[model samples]
Target chain A: MMAVAADVPGAFERLVEAYEPRVKAAVARSINDRSSVEDLSQEIFLRLYRARQRYRPTARFETFLYRVIFNACVNFTQYMARRRALSLDRALDDDERGNALEPADPGMARPLENIEEQERAVMVRAAIDTLPEAQRRALLLSRYEGLGYEAIGQIMGLSLQAVKSLLWRARDNVRKALIPKLGEGPDA
Target chain B: MPDHERIGDGPVLSEAQEQQLLAYLDDRLSPDERSGVDAWLARDADLRRLLDEHRRTWELLGELPVPDEASPGAGFRENTVQRAHREERLRQRGARRRAMGVLAAAALVMALVLVLRDRPEPWARLTPEERHIVQNLELLENFDLLQQFETELDLAADVEALQAFEGELTETLR
Candidate 1:
């Protein structure tokens, strides 16, 4: 990150190569509009490039990166929401909006199992989406990316306790939402 | 009693206790904290159940497919680098343009100062009346010397007196 910051044009490709997976995953999980993931990812990299000079090594690089990703996702979500609100011909569902959840494995031998898994994935995603923005982000960062509470706090600009609270609420909410469909089985 | 101590009627744990459980689950707690939570979990059936539920819910998040297309795709690196370079060039160009603007403004100010510094004073570019006053400046200063003659007629009336007065005046002037 420091190298990229020093000479963004020259050293940025290395940074991109290193962090692209995490960046894409962050964007993918944050927004429901999967179609825009590529575009949003590109935009995020551009923003990172533009903001290279402001990077300070005092903070963790992933912390800084996640912060940028969080802000971008938020802005993109808000923009999409407003666009949807303004458009007379808006889609009724995410599927119609061209963000249908793809099956985990399209060519799997067990089509039934794949479809069920895809449905569960969609349900879980929808549950996640129902959470407030902060809770959702906190959940994603903590659960998916496996970031610690302090890092999550830094990324979200929350206190450690606040992050803990968000994560708890996020998990509780998802649990409540899923329990009816999934049942209180040992695995569930 | 704090709300977290009770079980089975409403929310089993207070928010703080729930947060602690979450921290424990995430392995964020210190060993002592973890031990305390573990002891509580071992003793309390409700707390254990809640922990299990939270754990399962967290695990359920794994079902959300790790985007197989995690890569930003082919040419992403090259594209991003090219775009960054393009933006950098544009920014540098903008900076250069701004510098040129500032230099142009400074040059204009300097030119104005030079023009003003070597400029003739307002009085030096005299009007006709001012020119006349300047031409007769010495005469104006010595008007009392002319008092010897009442008029030109008197000077003509006593030509010898005028000639003597002129010689005296020349001697005084010398």
Candidate 2:
């Protein structure tokens, strides 16, 4: 990131290579619009470029990058919602569908067991989607990004306590949803 | 023994304590803090149960869908870098144009001032009739002064003085 700031050749490209997957995954998790992921992720990188000069190393670069990704996904989601509201006649096309909810592998060599596992995974995705927006974002950042509450707070612009409360509620929500699906184990 | 030890440590977990336990399970706590949470969990059945629930919940969340590792198609990086470079060029161009505009405006004001200073008086641009109009402006301004004198002779003397004042005024203005 510092190298990119110094305008080193190929430095920005190195950043793109290193962080693109994480950025894409974050975008994919945040919004339901699957087709717009690529464009939204690209916009995040462009935003990073525009803000390169202003980049301060106050927190982890991943934290800063996720903040950028989070803001962009939120804006994109709101935009899509407005589009939907205004153009109710044009229902969502297949491309704009929740492709993220689809299992990664449709054809499993293990047949029945894999299908059952995949079904649980799909239910988990749906449960995550049903989480309140703030809780969902916090949960995704915590679990997927492995970010600490302080960093998540910084990214979400909430107090550390607020983030902790949010994550607790989010975890409880997911647990409730998963219990019936995953079965009554010792954890339940 | 377990109940007595747990009562001393704080039996009912607050929302924050519960969150801390979850964070501890996620390995978010430091070594010393983890040891403290470990002691608590060892002593309390309810706390241990809560920790187990949180751990399983986290595990299930880990199953959240991840997109396939397909490439973001060709030229994505190239296209983004090119657009950024183009935007930078446009921004710099806009700044330069703005600076040039300020310089042009300053130069124009300077040129006007120099032309007016080095060139003849503005009276030079006036036609004879216009000059006559200019010369009578003081008279128009002091027409009331002419009405104050009762005699025609006094009025003529005052008119002569006023004409001399107008000449001085035009010279000073020029």
Question: How does the DockQ of candidate 1 come out?
Answer: 0.45
DockQ of each model vs. true complex = 0.45, 0.34
Q: Model 1's CAPRI class? A: acceptable
lDDT against the true structure, each candidate: 0.80, 0.79
Angstrom error at residue A140, model 2: 1.1
lDDT of 1 by residue, A165-187 (tens): 88888888888887677875775
- The residue-level lDDT of candidate 1 at A22 comes to 85
